[model samples]
Structure formats: structure tokens, C-alpha cells
Target chain A: MHEEPLVRWDWIGRNWPNIQVLLEDHVVMSLVPIVVGLLVALPLGLACVRWRWLYQPTVGVMNVVYSLPSLAVFIVLIPVTGLATRTTVMIPLTFYAMAVLIPAVVDGLTAVPDHVRQSAVAMGFTPLRRLLRVELPIAVPVVLAGLRVAAVSSISLVSVGALVGRGGLGYLFIDGWQRQFYTPIIVGIVLVVLLAAVADMLLVLAQRLLTPWSRARGSA
Target chain B: MVAGEGVGVNWLIDFFGDPANWSGPDGIPVRLLEHLQFSALSLLLAVLIALPLGLWIGHTGKGALFAVLSANAARALPTLGLLVLIVLLMGVGTDIPVLIPLVALAVPPILVNTYEGIRGVDPELRDAAYGMGLRGGQVLGRVLVPVALPLILLGLRIAAIQVVSTATVAAYVGLGGLGRFIIDGLATKDFPRTIGGAVLVALLALAVQLGFTFIQRLVVSPGVSERQAVR
Candidate 1:
């Protein structure tokens, strides 16, 4: 077990191209749904703030959606949607992101300091304008933090779709499990972990790049 | 959008209405109850191990670094990959899937909370104890652990919730759990049954979270949260 495969020259020559292609496809499948979910959930989260009654009931429903087991969601979708396609892959993935995103977005927007909102109000900014310029800019980091968590989770989860023939790293893991093989399975596992690390790192980088002030805020 | 028809969602309703689901070659509800039992058993085991160890490491002063790393790694590692590795070694039936993911889901919150509680203990209280010549055991029992109780409880709550959610993945190992209902529902394309399992898992998580929060109100004193920002 201690004797590990360290991506030797020969191994890299043979596997790197395949790995690259596999990873690219995996990233796309994972991200596409995330983007879609954000498009839907973000507006809804904002709408919760605008319409008071919608907050509790809207969040409550999304919470239920969020808490549903990933497998259960996938299985349920199979019958109505049938086996693999973007719909099968995206719908459940969207729900998964929704669970994390909705609350985070709401909390983030709410966390925008009172003074910031006051300044906007004093300046006669409309609710939508205040949200875009002041509220959202401040909340962006916390919102992104939630996205970071969901992004990594969704990427790993896309594999479950593979069991239904979506084709991703999960195929390798499941394949290896049935045959009792370790190499390909380990390869898939390592790749997923690497994918998570890369995704997390990208988020970290974005936090730094997009909010140059965040690093200063952290240290100070 | 479209009303349910393609997967014959009604069979599931019919199945649930009938009592025959309990005697499966893999009986649906029976398998689900068994799955919950498995998750509960493993989560109980994990909380037992993690809580004390977390407390010990957090209070020890020198142990927090390792605890943080362990928690981070536990959170980051993919549960599915971990289960697959375990099934390879153990040749799956029940244990690998149930225990592996349960533990993976748990470690972070437990470890972090324990550390927070320990570190949150008053520095002056520690000096006062030393000035009065208190022993390490007495300090841990009287001062450190109680102060940390709320955070440790919080950690347990988080781990518990994740365990419930992750346990649904156990069916991949051929273990009978609620996951089996989901698997069957998916195979048959029965929306209500599939949705039924999903709703139940969601409810279970919500119920557990609420129960734990209610319990936290009892374990953690008002003073403890004032210092929650310490670590």
C-alpha cells in the first residue's frame, strides 16, 4: 500500500491526454448545472428579500430540496426523465447547488452592513441599484464561499450520474469496484480529489483576484 | 410542468399502501429502515470516538494542529471514493459503506468544536486553577470540558446531519438501507416512491438538526457563545 504510483514519465505519456479529456468533460458537466442553478436560485434568493412572505416558505421548500439525498434524487429522476442526458445530470445537480446557494445568498445579502445600505438610501439609489452596487459587492465573498463548497460537491457528485450512463470519473470507480480492481479506481479517486483541490484553489484565487480587499481584510 | 406518468409513480403509492414491502428479496421499506439503522449505528460509533478524542486533543494544547488537519482532510476526501476503496479491501456487504461514509461525514465539526471549546476556556481561569494547584484531570473535568461542551455538541449536530444525508449512499455497496428504495424507485422510474425517500431523508435531517439545536440550548450556557469567536 505504501508503494504509490507517482505519475512516472511513461505513465504520464500514456495517460495524460486521456486524463485531460476526461477532466475537461467532468468540469463541464459539473459546472454547467451549477451556473444554471445560480441563475435560478440567485434571483429567487433576492426576491425573498424584496417580498417578505416569500422568504420563509421559499427557503423552506429549497431546504427540503437541499436535504434530499443525492441518490434518491437521481433515482427519482430516472423514471420521469429516463437514463443519461444533460437533464438527468443537471436537474439534480441544480437542486444540490440550490440547497447550499439559496441560504448563503440570502444570508450574504442580509449581512451587508447597515451603513452601506444607509449610504445607498441617502444617495437615493433604487432597491435594485443598491442591491447591484453596494449589497452584492459586499456579499460576494460569502456568496462565493458557498459556491465553492457546492462546486466541489457537485463535481464529485456528477459521478453518481455515471451509474446511469452519464460517463464521468464515477464510471472508473464503479467499474473498478465491480471487478475488484484498484489502479483505475484509485486513479479515479485521486482525480476527483485533485479536481476538488483545483476547484477550491480556483475559488480561493477568484476571491483574491475579484475582491482584492479580501486578503487585506483577512490579515487585518 | 408535466404531470407524473412516465415512470408509473402510482405503483410506488400502491406498494406503500400495501404491507408486502417488508419481505423483500430486498423489501423496500424494510431495507430503508435497515439502512437508517446502519447509519444510526455507525454515527453513534463515530460520535463516541470523535467527541472524546476531539476533547482530549483540543485541551492538550499541542494536539490542535493535528486535529485541524485531520478534520480538513476528512471533509475534503470524497465519500464515494473512500467507500469503493473500503469495499475493495473488505468485500462489501454492509460495514464498509455504512461506516466509511459515516465517519468521513463526521470528523470535521466534532474536531473543530472540541478545539474551539478547549481554547475558549478562560486563560485567567487556567492560571487561577494553577495558582490553587489544580491537577490536569481536575482542570479538564471542571473547567475545560464544560466550557467546550456547547461547541462539542454543535460539532456532533453537524456530523449527525451529514451522516444521515450520506448514509443514503450505502446501497452502492449492496447494503439494504433507504437507498435501496431510491434505487428501486429510480429503476422503476416511480417518482412518488423516489420522491418519498428523498422527502424522508430531508425530514430526518431537518428533525435531527432541530433536535440537536434544542439540545445545544441545554448543553451550552449563555456565556459559552460569547466566546465562540475565540478560535
Candidate 2:
């Protein structure tokens, strides 16, 4: 049998502004890792692809790093980075983003057909120029797909940082659990899922906008 | 470098070196066992549910959409959030609240990988096995399972380490695990204990990773593994 209604709309309407702030915090924490991860991973992933020997080791290290729990990473940094600091969450989050993104970047670049790469080289495109003008653009969709996973997981893990004090929508879950109230927990789950969906959609949109040729080739 | 402020390697060594910390109800060994118990049970339950479901779906090719959707949905669900939410509903004091979420967290990889691995089997091989008058179950157990073994093991590795790491969240529910050190240390402001716990948990995860990698090598089909080696 079902229990009382968990969705408290009137309560949500009353606390709209506070909810808005939490949502903003969630988005900020989530997006920062994606941007930082891409900046760091792009070059590292390129180097791995270029060097060939570096790929396995890089991925192996990333897997190990990826396996570390987010909460532990946050708590472990408290003495060094201090609790409630964005750096504590951001640094570990960035590492996680890199762990997922680097492999995605490598896969995307490698997925580019070898003949296509050779033709780009034969066209007088310098190595850097080819990567920028040809390979990277082709790799965009794959990289963005990986970005979605990194982004969504970061958004979820950032909630764990709430245990230290401040993190976005996660505080609601903590508060609700402590008080045994369902509203905040329900609201947090709903809003967090909505945020992930919206973020995923935005990335999809960005991929489409950036790669118009993909659509054209698809139709042809 | 300060006596009480910095949690150095010496601090970890000293924390671990203490004999008192290894033998009681609250000792490191006890907590480590508790953590392993929680993680192992969660992994076992997850495998029980996901493996068969994944195999069935992969074998049938029906409900493939459900597998994708569930994997994505599971990924998006925050583990901590789910744990707390379930606790609130179940009225905690039992491990069920904690185990439920951990199981939820563990399932997606196992299910997705098993499904994908089985589906990726060469259609011709599948057809040949069926043509040989083998029953559906026989084809799946003999042909699909062997071919899909590497990916399934990979999935298990990912799931096992993940469950081990995330099981630390069990401490939040007032359950005993290695996370007690981190949580209790933070509450009492014991920097050494906190850092020591975090290090231990990391090491445990790394050990699990190593153990799984070794198992994967031993269990993977040598023919399939040869191809991976060449690649």
C-alpha cells in the first residue's frame, strides 16, 4: 500500500528562491569539472595518441583513480584543502572528469579513419593543424558523449561533498534524511534528475551545433 | 610538519602500527571485515539479479531498450541520495537501507556489460551452435558465456571496486565499516585517523582492482585473450 503524498508542491513554491540557489550551486559544481577536465585531458589525450606507448599506462592510472570513492577523496583533502572549500570538491571532481574524458578523447581520435588521417596529412596540413582542423572536429561527438557521463557523475558525486557542509541539491537529501521528512529528499531527487537531463540535452545540442556536417552526411 | 596538524606518512604508519587498533570490536580488522561483508553481499546480490537478467535480454534481443534505459537511469541516481532516501522510508537500524542503494549502484555495469558482451557474440557462431541442435540454454551457457567472459569479468571488476568504494557511505547510516574512521575521526577532529581510514579504503579498492585483473587473466578464454594481447 502507498503512503501519504511525498511531493509537497506548496512547500516547494514557498522555498522557491532557496531551491533556485541550490540548483545554481549544483549546475556550477557540475559544469566546472567538465570545463577543467576538457582543458587538461585534451592535451594529455593527444599526447597519448601521439606517443602510442603512453595510452595504456594513462588509462590504467585513470582506472585506478576513477575507483577511488568521491567521499573519501573529499574527506582525505580536509586537512590539506580544508573542509567546505570548493577546491576540495573541485580538485577530485576534476581528476574524475579527466579519468573518464581522456579515454573518450583517445577513442574518439583513434576512431577517425586512418585513410582520413593520411589524406589530411597529404593536404599540407601540419600535425597540429590536422588535429585541430580535421581530427578534433570529427572526435567531437564521441568526446561530448563521454563528457555527458563525466558531467552527470560529477553532479551526483558533488552531492556527497554535502557531508562536509555545502554542496548543491545534496544538502536537501541530507536534511531530509536527518529529519525523516520526505519532501526535501523527493524534491532533491527530482531536481537532480532534471538537472542531469537538462545538462545532457545541452551537450547534445552543442554537439549538433558544432558538427553540422554530421547531420548532412547522415542525411546523404 | 606540526605534531597535531599534519597527517604525514608517519601518522598513517603510527595509526596502523598501534596494537590496540587491531583487536577489539572497533578495531581496524573488525571494521575492515564489516566493510568487506557489506561490499561482498552487495556485489553478490547485484550479480544474482543483473547477470541472469542481462543474459536473458542479451540472448533474446528483446527488451534491449530497457537495458540501455536502466543503465542510464542507474548512472544518474546519486548513491548517497538513494541511500538516505531509502533509510528515511525504511526506518534505518538495518543494513537493508544501505544494501539496497549499493546494489542499485552495482547493477548497471554488470547488466550493461553482460548484455553487450552476449550481444556482441558473432551471429554466425550463434547460428552454428543452434544449428548443431543445441538447445537455447545450451547455446547460451556454452557459446555465449565463454565468448562474453572477458567483458563480463570486466563488468564485475568495475562493479566490485565501485561497491567497495561506495560502501563507505554505509557509515552515514550509523553502520560499521572502514568509513567509521573517516566519519568518527572527522567528528572528533582526529586528523591521523581520518587520513588513515581514507588511505586504507583507497588501498582496499586498489587491491580489489588488482585481484580482479588477475582473475580476469586467469578466466578469460586464451583464444580471446590472444587477440587482446595482439591489439
Candidate 3:
């Protein structure tokens, strides 16, 4: 049998359009979860901080949810969400994002010094205004750090959805493996890793821009 | 449709209720064992490689930048992609291809946590240990390792859980494990087997989590453990 090369540039050139679609699907699937999770986590994290008692139990439950295999979660959701659907994949990814983001949100909020809060109060700032204008801005660096992890992991994990027929770039892995071809598999891995790197870099840039004071403090 | 869904749920229960599914080469027990074997072996390999490197970087503080950067890079590599890529590259006759990705997946958490744990130790404690005339190895073993034990254990627990969960991918490439139920069932459209497999995987992951929590309580010093809890 004539051996296939590790990569076929010709195959990629021909399949560029399909690959682009998968790459776009991968990006959307990965990004939506982080956005949705941050929205959900912000409220939940605030509630956890407010209640104090709720914090430990919320974290405990989230940890358990995080440990469940992504594949299993996708399969289990098949009944509710149907198979080969983007929703089935995105739901589990959202939970995983929340698992990371909630802690980031909470830790970011908690790290705001007591004196900072007191000054906000002394300045006649409403609780909502204080949180919006003061606490959340301070929490940007920590929250961005969490966002980095969540984004990277979510991008990587969206590939597992390929098992259920919606894995975005992950579909390439299954396709390549089933045919014993290397192009799709290699393409998938590279794109996923690159996507993660790009997303992480963007978040780091956002942190630097949003929290310039943090870099000064960090260096000091 | 509702009635059909009810039947599906019942079949899932019956899948577990059947004694015939409990034994033999194709049974749950055999699959469970394969899953654990894959997880355990991969974890062992990961720890052997990561632990020493983490310790060296942590203790000496050299290459700390390199370690953190590489670990983060590893984190971003999709496990499914790595698994398939290795299988394609190695031609998938042995279990080595599967083990490579599993170990790769497990390494970053263990390495980062171990390094952070050691580096997080107070300088005062290190100085006190050195002041007692303890050699470098002795200070690391006696002072640093004990203090860093909780985080190290936490890393192992995270790695173990991840390995167990991801081990399901083994069945994708014709290896036997609990994931067999998932992949086979999904292929055959057997909802019972699929859900049952997912339940088992989730349960196993939870057991691993609880097992680590128990071990942490048993082994971590009361002072260190309590301090961690407070944090």
C-alpha cells in the first residue's frame, strides 16, 4: 500500500471552505458559553458573596459538575436537547465555563479591600452603583484570569462535541481517524490550539488595558 | 412521544437491572476495569514526569517562567484532538497512543499546582529549616513538601478525575472501557446503554473526587488543612 503523507496540503487547499465553516462553528460555540457563563456567574457570584453561607455549597456543586466527563454530559443531554444540535454541545460547555468563572467573580469581588468598600459607602454610592462602578472594575484582572482559563478550556472542549456530530473542528478528528487520514486530525488540533492561544492573548490584552493599575501594583 | 420517552427511561433502568450485563468479557465489570487501568497508568506516567520537574522548578525557582508557559500551552491543547492525532500518527495497534494524550492531559494540572504549592511556601519556614542545619534535600523534604502537600494532593485529584472522565475516548479507537457502552450504544442508537454509561462515568468521577477529599483529610496536617479551609 502506498503510504499517505503526514499532511496533504492539496487536500487542505481543496477543503479550505469546509474547514473555514468548522473553524467558525468552533469559535461561536466556544465564545457563546463564555459570554453566557459570565452573565450567569456574575449574578450567582454576587449572591454567593452576599449570603456568605451560599459560597461553599455553590462551589462544591460546581466542582462536582465540572468533574463529570464532557462526553457523558453531551450524551445525557441528548434526550433533552436532541443529538447533533449545537445546543446539546453548548449547554455542558456553559456549565464548565461557569465552574471556572464563578470562582473568578467571587474571588475578584472579595479581593476588593474593606477600605475601598467603606469609601464607596462614605461617598453615598448606592450598592448597585458601588458594585458597578467600583467593585467590578477592581475585579477585572482576576475575572480576566478566570476568563482566560474558561476560554481556553471551552475551546478545547468544544471538540468533544464532535462525538455527538457537532464538534465543530472536532469533527475533523473523527473524520480523519475513521478514514486513517491525517489532514483533518492535524488541522483540527492546530486550529483548536491556535484558537485557544488567540483567545487567551485577547483576554490578557483586555486585562492589561482594563487594569493598567494592576500591572503597576504587580510589579511593585 | 412521551410514552416512547418513558419506555426509554425504563429500558435504561432495565439495562442496569439485568444480571446478564454484570459478568463476562463484555460486561460492565470488565469495562470498568479497563477504564480504571487506563486512568491509573496514565496518571502514574504523568506524575512521574511532572512531579520531579515541578519540584525542581519549585525548589530552585529556575525555569519557573518556562514551566508556567508550557503548562498553559498544554492546557490549551484539546484532548480529543490530541488523542485522534496520536492514533493517526502511531497507527493505533497498542495502547500507547491512547496513553500519550491521557498523560498529556493530566500533566499540566499536576505540574502547575505542584510548582505553585512549593513556591507559595513561606520564606520564613525555609529559612528556619535551613537554620536547623538541614541540607537542601532535607529542607525540601521536611519543610516544603509537607507544607505543599495539600495543593499537591489537590493537583493529583484534579488530574485523576480528568483522566477518568476523558478515558472514555479510549473506546472511540477500539479500546475497551466503560466508554464502550457510550460509543457502541450511540452507534447503535441504544439510549439505555448510552445513558447508563454516562451515569457510570459521572459516578466514577464523583467517587474519585470524594476519595481525594477523604485522603486530603486523612493525610494533610490539621493545621495545614484548617488553614486551607479558611482560605
Candidate that scores best on DockQ = 3
Candidate 2 Cα errors over 4 Å, as ranges: A1-5, B1-5, B8-14, B229-231
The residue-by-residue lDDT of candidate 2 on B127-226, one tens digit each, is: 9999999999999999999989888888898899879877887687777899898888878877678888888898898889889888888888898877
Q: Candidate 1 residues A1-220, lDDT tens each?
A: 6654422346546876776776777788888878887887789889876786887877667755665556656655765676676577778888878878877788888888889899999999998898888898888888898888788878888776665666477776676777776765677778887887888899889878877776876865
Candidate 2 lDDT, tens digit per residue, A1-220?
Answer: 8676777788889988998998888888888988999999999999999999999989989988988888888877776777787778888999999999999899999999999999998989998899899999999989999999998888888788887776788889888877787888888888888888888889999999989998988954
- By TM-score, who's the top model here? 3
Whose lDDT is greatest here?
3
Model 2 Cα displacement at B128 (Å)?
A: 3.2
Q: Score the docking of each candidate (DockQ).
A: 0.41, 0.58, 0.69
DockQ for candidate 3: 0.69
**Which is superior by DockQ, 1 or 3?**
3
lDDT of 3 at A91: 96
> Candidate 3 residues A144-215, lDDT tens each?
999999999999999999999999999999999889888889988899999999999899899889988868
Query: Could you tell me which residue pairs clash in candidate 2?
Result: none
Q: How many angstroms is residue A29 displaced in model 3 relative to the true structure, after the best TM-score fit?
A: 1.0
Interface RMSD of each: 2.7, 2.3, 2.0
Docking class of 2: medium
Q: What is the C-alpha lDDT of each candidate?
A: 0.72, 0.86, 0.89
